[model samples]
Target: MRRLFRLLTIYAVFARYRLDELLPDHAASGIVKFFIRLHPAAWTASTQVHPWGRLRLALEQLGPVFIKFGQLLSTRHDLLPEEAIGDLANLQDNVPPFGEQAAFDIIEAELKGTTEALFGHLERTPLASASVAQVHAGSLKDGREIVVKVIRPGIETLVQRDLALLLTGARWLQKIVPETKRFHPVQVVTDYRHILLGELDLGQEAANGAQFRRNFADSPVLYVPEVHWNLSTNKVLTMERVYGVPVSDTQSMLAAGVSLEHLSELGVEIFFTQVFRDNFFHADMHPGNVMVSLKDPQNPQYLSLDCAIVGSLSKQERFLLARQLMALLDKDYEQIAILMVEAGWVPQSTRIHEFQNALRTVLEPVLERPLNEIEFGPILIRLFQTARRFEMQALPQFMLLEKTLIHVEGLGRQLYPELDIWEIGRPLLEQWLRDQIGPGAIMQTIKRNGPALIEQIPHIPKLAWDALQEMRKLSENQQKLLQQVEQGHLKQLRRDRIITLLGLIGLGAGLSWGFNPHWSLSWSEIPLGAWVISALGASLILTRLRSNPDD
Candidate 1:
């Protein structure tokens, strides 16, 4: 019954905003328009505001989930109209704060103590109120300034209810419009559900913050405030209070003598460093969570906040991504297409030349533009959209990274219109690639694993002997199977071939061990016993192959 009510509320809001008009002309839209026109609210709905403005207002009225949806939509410049994207960009997490009493109740309950006992002084009002939580300024017992972030009470319930409604709506839309399947609305909502729920856990956010602080402990590029673990809980987080001009507050930052050019470059540097060097990065880098430090205006630094959502890629993914970026810079569309298929980002059967042509058609014009005029965010979006034509699947792991890149690019451009991320990022990426595959990296890998290899050296002879014994048994078995095959038992021929294949694999393993680079001993210096094993294994494999060429 409650869900039905929520559905009705959503419908009323949709009608009130006349959102049906926003839909493209289609059979589905015609049906929706007919129903909306029949509704009494639609007749009385205000027409004074632009449709985009009405849409934004309706989302805000629907609460946090919808407001966040609007924010996400704002990044998709290709999908949304310019005016709609502009309006949605204005959707901020500026929800009104809950009462002061409720805030104190939550903090006390989470910390297991009264506000007065836990702090020297706690504010009666919130410093900032966002969709998921609100922050209140306070001082610790040691007179250190801090901010207590308290998750709004009952928000989890509200989020879950809204998510369920969203999922239903998504499924309904997909059913009504089969073409929407490519967009994967259901999976998108499911991912958003996990992200929203994760934001509800302050403990996770605290851990993320601690790790980020440690990553940049000595760096001037960024600062992550200290997390007060003792005073934090899943419901409440306490951290050192930081003061800086918001990155979006251009006038204030300029007044403080902050170099916008340096600041914008630093933003790009911070992103590359976090993604490539540390592998862990704060995924939520919107202006609200980022501020510019004033300690040194000439050498500006970023103060990062709200580390609840961070992103990291697997080692293989990082390597492939670096190669892909390098290829993009070099205009090697063929390599980009090859890497996408190799990474399983696209189907294995994808026609490489065709894919390359598609990429070139989409990206050549963008790459032709001046470095300062190119927007990496939209380019990535276009690349993914092009890949979708060849049946590229959804990449849930990259959603946060994509969102962060868009935020970073948007913020960098806002700070300095001429910010050339390509200039700032190319060298860092090149250096990182060299470090990953150069001789130093090889030495480091060997040094890290040398001890274990040495420890296993003594057991190699025993393992090799065991393998030889197994080979002998298999050889004997193959002889019998081959004899049976000669007697017209064709089934035994397949078994003989299987035994021969196994023996070949065992011999290959022994040969690889003998030639392993970590072994300091030369071929002449190798123990006689090891040489015997290698020779015997090689001779057996050769004899079998010579005797049965088909096998």
Candidate 2:
């Protein structure tokens, strides 16, 4: 019954989006066509809005869960066509805001103080409203402007229930369609669960903000909002409010004397710095979340918001990813293959040559275009599809990192179409490589690993002795196993040889008795085939006794 309800809800969403028109009928995918035919009345063609428009509208009506799904799907340009992906990228939480009193109640409860006590000046109206939370502009007691973000009443409950429903449906789908297990749908759900839960805690978001701020601490190119530690809570966040025109407002930015070219370059710098230097990035980077600092026209600074969904890479992953990108840039498909396997995105059993051919198929066309013309989204999607053929597992870390980078790149393109992110980013990458591989990097590594190395010095001889003892045991076990196989084979050989010897003795005695005309039975009375069988048995036993174990 729950399955039916969820399926019906999905069908309704599909109908609302009028996706039936965009999809093929009998020619579409088997599952898609089946769904379409079953709900002919539920879906309609585009007589009103474009398919993309309708999709956005449909996702909007479906609310947060579906919106977030669409948002994630937007990053997967490889799966959805460009048009559909564009529409989905536009999806956001535009649902009506919860009441201001509700927001006030949250702030008061989470901060353990009244709104007045928390903010020197508070607004009855929210600065912005969204599905999960709403923001209100206020002032701190020190007369500094701040944005008080409060979670909507009952949202956590709603999100939790919806996530449970999604998990149940996903598991049901996996059971019904075993092939989808290849996609690791369960892991995707778990990944989404982490992001959603992290978003629920305002303190985590504050921490994310703090990390970003620290990463770009001395940078003149970006401004991460300062988290108000004193007044922040798990459900409420008070941040140093930033005032600037949205990066999307090209005219306003131009009017304010911000340089679009420099702004675009700075955007790339921020991305490389986050990924290569900091290993942390703001994952939810929509246009609204980005703003331009008006004070620096020639060298624009970015003001980023909503750090609930950030990305991080492990040290090993970062190393492999950098090498992978560098290999792709150099057109060395073999290195790309090696690095991907090293990253564990591909299995060790993956045929490198075949993987290279698949990669070259998608990558050659992409590299043909100039770096500025590269669409990171479609490239990722193509790479994902090619890797999928080789049974690649999308490491959640890399997938999210790639998504964030694409988001940053896409935002750059939106603001400045001719922006060459790679141009601005390559120097940074080179410098980062130098800092990592140069003498300084070696010194740091030694510094970090030295203490542990010294601690192991006194135990080295004893540890080596222990390891040698273990090696001896392992060798003994292998020898025993080999001997057991040899013994079993020899036993079979011995049994055959013994049976043959007995048969030979009997056959020789019978033959001699017959030739001498002293046999007990007449030739007519004896079985004629018995002597032939005895002779054959003797030959078989001789062969078994001479048989080799390898054979």
Q: Per-residue lDDT tens digits of candidate 1, residues 1-551?
A: 88889888988998999988788787987988888878889999987899899999999999999998787667554345558877998986778999899999999988899999999999988998988999999999999999999999889888999999889989998999998776778887887777777889999999999999999998889999999999999999999999888999999889988889988998999999999999998887888899988888888889999998788998778888899999998999999999999987788999999999999999999999998999998788778778878877646666667778888999999999999998989999999999999999999999999999999999999999999999999999999998977876566566566656766766666666667678887877766655666666667667667867876
State the lDDT of candidate 2 residue by residue for 1-551, as single tens digits. 65467668767777656676665333324576467557755545444788777878877876787678777767654345667777887786777778888888878887888877767998879888888888898899989999989888887876776678778867865776676677676777777888788888889999999988888887798888899898998888989988888888899988877777778777888888888888887888778788887876766789888899988888777777777777877889988887888767779988888899889988899988988888766677778778877777867767677778787887788878988777887778778778878999999999999999999999999999999999999999999999999999789877866766776776675566445455567667665565675566566556655664343
Give candidate 1 misplaced runs (Cα > 4 Å): 22-37, 46-54, 76-87, 174-176, 346-354, 384-394, 448-466, 469-551
Which structure among the candidates has the greatest lDDT? 1
Off by over 4 Å in 2: 1-53, 177-181, 337-366, 369-378, 381-393, 434-439, 458-503, 517-551
* lDDT of candidate 1 at residue 263, scale 0 to 100: 89
